[model samples]
Target: MALDRLPAYVRKLRNAAGEPVYYWELPAWARPVKDEKTGAMVPAMRNGKPMLLASEKLGSDLAEVHRKAQLLNAALTDWRKGAEGASMVPGSVEWLFQWYRKQARFTSKKAKTRADYGKLMDMLAARETKKGAPPFGKRRAADVDAAAADRLYEMLRADTGPRQASYAMQVCRLVWSWATRHYKVTGVKENPFMGMGLTSTAAKGNRATSRAEYTAYRAKAVEMGFQSMATAAALCFEGCQRVSDAFGYVDPDAPDRAAIVWEGYQPGVEITLVQSKTGNPVTLPLFEEVPGEGGGVERVPLYPELEEELARSREATRSATGPIVVEERSGNRYVERRMSNVHRRICDAAGLPKDMTFTGFRHGGITEIGDAGEDDVRPVSGHKTLAVTRIYNKANAEKARRIAGARRRHIAAIGALDEARTK
Candidate 1:
């Protein structure tokens, strides 16, 4: 919490409990004064003297402090310039985007997500049409129809690709919906970007990795002295965790980094996790058993590879204090990009496909569950709906085999009945 890095006109003070709190204050010149006759707060002056304004209390959370401070700064600028300081022409797409950025929905998104959306917005504002008359951002929101949105999508699809174009349209659709519902954006009734039947190509390169490929990748990683990477991949494949969640990164704001701790894990028993992306509580079992026909239970290790890898990692870092997946060279958690690079190296050494990414392992794990004839994958996959979980069920070989066997039995029964009737 550096004082110089904080926004202008913000003060940091300690509360009674010794916790820091933030507050925003406006300059006397820009502050609105209360009128004696109208009993209303308005910008005015009496005897050429400026009135004092109370400081606004921003929460102690640093992120919240920054968001509130930004909005207040915008207000201060508008007040200082009166009617002349509007950032953009009202009711324009550019204006809408700028406004939307100030809202909580945009500010509260993950940093990576916000940055991606920012790039798309900037591209939209700078893109030129064949006529070269004006950029799309300058167009009035009121004038934009479904046809105009379609043209914009087509232009983006041609310039970039279908994946990028679909994402851009999705973002615009959300912005339009938010503006329409929250603010009375003039002449903007229907959302033009809605229901465009967008088909995304985001999943084109990320095909599910096979179990054999995963095993080879892990073996290669371990041979290359990337023991942490090996365990991280296992977490993605066996635990069905995202890369970010599995190999936690250093958070500058927090005292401790987010990762799997030794306390949550009980080898050959169970492990608990609260997924960062969806905030869903996931408890994964390391061992399972089912009833056998002979009145005995057949034991199944839920994630035997992961369990063994984690055990080895614990033994190596027995004296060190931190996450389970610490770099052997450095006793720190593997950053997401570093992990991905190591995974690529392992894939090349293992003679696997170049497109086989660490993310695909998670998909592979879910698909394996589906292939095993699991009725519900939402619990382990942390998906809110069966629909979302079904997307990862790529290998339908077992399902097809079951249907084929049923059809064969039906044909055989039909032939027998027909022969009996003839006799």
Candidate 2:
């Protein structure tokens, strides 16, 4: 296209290398403005560098050039219009969100966490009073009472389902709490979301993987050449660890190698590491030997099944160090989601219930130990409290039945003794 045919402020210039470059120059009347998406000053002209026109690279694509020019013009116009719009009203939900974003509670979160929360905030911002009314975010914060909070939660639940509704409610509760404590806005007494009853409809019960399920899943994984999945299952089951901690890795050469590495094959030895989620230090015994009833010999605690899986993984990676669970094809370390997908696939092949997840291995192992009346599993599970461990104990019903049977037998024995003494 000819230079005269291009829009105003669209000019071609020569670089230091004498190559042609095209960029848009903001009008002299327009001042530097902040771009909300990037938090950067726009109309960037430093070092003779500004927003490059895609059309310049497209060559003879006149249609693409026109589209790019239109988009750039529209963006500039929108920025100018937004700058002239009304400012956020104090005590409004929008104002509170802006203030909350600056607080340590929100700012201290990880980038991914903040991004996830931002999606929920966007959802809340789009929610209208009814169907075509103003957005809920524009409503005054003080106008939200307990009933209003409940209604909003109900709406969110109906729209997005319980998990997202619960999560959104949690974010709102945090902001409302911060506002109640910090913001001195009048008519704002207590946080309406504080005591709002928002329960998750997500399944409360996690199906524990049975011994049969574990065996079947492992066999299927090995048959499919997914040794990493088998290794992950063993790690969670034997170590009583969460999937994240089970698959966690650090540089093999790092000083923290001891925390993740399993040393030599000593029978009574244990592997020590800190739990990734709870940060609680845990020592998992490598073996468990129990004395036979006949007192023949002491059993060795060597976990041959787990050892085999670990050895298989090590052979696959050809490394003495690094993450045990990895992609079979690329030998890349597995992220949590990727590992979960592998687990799901394995479960499908094993014909296991849909509710059985990778996490169930940890819960099942812990529950099995609990069923055996062994409190030592707590050290391996790395639960902060016995209560937390009990929560994972799905063998409570069986334990209760066993206890009841034992009580009945003891009562009968006492009655027999009393009758014998009377005779």
Candidate 3:
């Protein structure tokens, strides 16, 4: 009905203050359209539900009721005047979401957060299409409402982990806010994720590994008798690198070029890398750690743990499609879930009690550093804190013996000299 137009609605619901009011009788929150078949004004339904206000004649606070009505009236009046066609709604929601993301106090937000935000939007659009709703190409971003937003979140909850789903929703709030402010897509002021909901399971993310767990995992990998996984797991345990960190960046031919040769302690083909998650620059030496001129690590100034493993794996596999680590069963790269399965299998075979994860290598690297007794080894592990690195670093037996033997030799020489002088 043209009477539902903002200008018309504003004129009809004016209070004494001259502010426009929202009609509580509208079926939907703000979609006050006239019914076509019955010619009755019907509101929008939430999950097929309509507003159910009871009619009772009792002495009530008419003043307070009128005050609320005035506020609602003003909102409805403003919405009528301010909202453009349905096309303007999307822009409004996007604007509102952008504003909220900036205002949020979420800490330790990973680097891919922006990409996740985009993904959340995409997921929401897909959901609307699935539900035969707006913004599915024909629907403008402006047509979204509380019901649309709820359905968007509901779609994401089906498969994604609760915490990840919550993250997606958190970002959605920002996008909806943008829609409201700029496009007036939905006039929801309060964030859907302000507190928590049945879907708000965001606390479980990181899963840490212990030393005993690593030991058992190592045994399991060996026992499973899967040469490929064992090799991958062993390389991981020895190097303390993410599986992708090892497989994603490898150049075996770098050594053949004179510019990229490992000349003892000198740097060769040193390139700075900004860790995808941390945004920290790391000078990566593109060389393999192998027996050099004197049985020491050769070929490059930096032969990272993963790099060495990658080089060895590539050397072994002449016709592999991708990644040094290949599945013995199918020769495919180990994805997260597959890697977990491998970890569990390896632990089971090795007689280890705790099911270790593929990430065990990172923790193992910490132990190797501690064993070497080099405080500088912390940075090499690609971790920010010493507390985490300490679990991986184990004391070197040879180095300990050397230090203790020197003190023992000195004491023995002094004792012999004292005995000779007394005689």
Candidate 4:
């Protein structure tokens, strides 16, 4: 191979196989500088460290190496001009994203949440407007009005799907709002992603799981050697708890990524827990006071079915002080993703609805309380607001039955006397 004029700073080396390898190391000028105000080192580029792309990425390809080297050289020139000349345009959607991601508001989110948002952001940043036009991300954030947001949404809807489009826009709206408040990004007067009336086709993705479906699914789960899953479902349904809160979750922000323990359970008394999402403390009594046959109040098991399942699980795992929802195969706590896969399989085998999910079980529990005419469900569901709790409360047969009973009583009191005529 003839040694041609290669771009500056792009070193060519020989691998063990005697193959030519290209490596790019940051020159002193392209390295990070300490901010005078914050006294912290910030890089010129997103990842401006030495890279082994010569051998690893563009291995043995001289032409491609030259191309990448040119790009790096260009990046170095841009860094010399500072933030205004960087590839990420100032006041652009991508710029806002970069700014937002560096802040505590975005960094403090759950690892999974940050990952999900990052995927959406990358998609938005990469999606081209036309055959060769720049992506939507390059456009100034202030230029994206409500109408422009809608246009972008339609593009996403056409490219992806309704649910995904809606989700992407929702994330966009969040980023925009954060920028307006904290970053105070100039030229961005309002958040266009807001009030776009974006409706999701999968709005009911987490539909309420009926009691019959819950029972059938539990039976199928146990039959399929997933007794732990069945018990976990019971806990979610009976306690109206999120899977992460009930079984614990892998939280990068948390110390040691703690898992749920059985220390809070007092047999035949009460169970206490703090919700992972909201940090709302919850204490559910084992028994509830209900009207007895003789008229006086009597204590009955609040969730008899869940109680039975817990008793069985406790007996099976006697002296174990780990997670309450353990995967039987591994004897470890169930991660929500794997648990969801297993739940889907069980639902399929049980002939349950395709949309039925572990989340739906929690939705069902909250709906059950609403159907039973509970005035305040926050204490039971551990919801922070009435509005949020209401989102899970779906119309059901129990609610209709109550309404019918109320109508009958009203008719009797009014002396309509139309029962014989109707018959």
Give the number of the best model, judged by TM-score: 2
Instruction: Encode model 2's per-residue lDDT on 128-240: one tens digit a residue.
Output: 54753556766888888888888889888888888889999898888788788875753466888887766684657777886567778889999988988887787777666
Better candidate number, 3 or 4, judged by lDDT: 4
Q: For candidate 4, what is the TM-score? A: 0.57
What is the C-alpha lDDT profile of model 3 across 231-311, one tens digit per residue? 565444543455555333221222121211112112243333223334333343434345778677765323343344344
Pairs of residues at least 3 apart in sequence or in different chains that clash in candidate 2 = 287-301, 288-301
lDDT of 4: 0.67
Which candidate gets the maximum lDDT versus the true structure? Answer: 1
Q: After superposition, how far is residue 214 of candidate 2 from its true place, in Å?
A: 1.8
- The model with the greater lDDT, 1 or 2, is 1
Pairs of colliding residues, candidate 4 = 22-54
What TM-scores do the predictions have? 0.54, 0.58, 0.39, 0.57
When 1 and 2 are scored with TM-score, the better candidate is 2
Task: Write one digit per residue (lDDT tens) for candidate 4, span 1-423.
Answer: 344876678778899999888876677655656544323344444342211112224456787676656555554554355335568778887677767777788888877788778678766765666544566767888887887788789988998999999999999999888777754555566788888887785766578987668889888987898877787788788778887776675444663544445777776666665576666456666654569999999875556667677777777667357667776765666555667788889988888888787888888877766665564556656676323344333332233223323333443543445565666
In candidate 3, stretches whose alpha carbon ends up further than 4 angstroms from where it belongs are 1-165, 184-191, 194-212, 222-226, 249-323, 329-341, 344-355, 367-374, 382-423
Stretch of 10 with least lDDT, candidate 1:
44-53
Candidate no. 1 TM-score = 0.54
State the C-alpha lDDT per candidate: 0.68, 0.62, 0.44, 0.67
Residue-level lDDT for 145 in candidate 3: 56
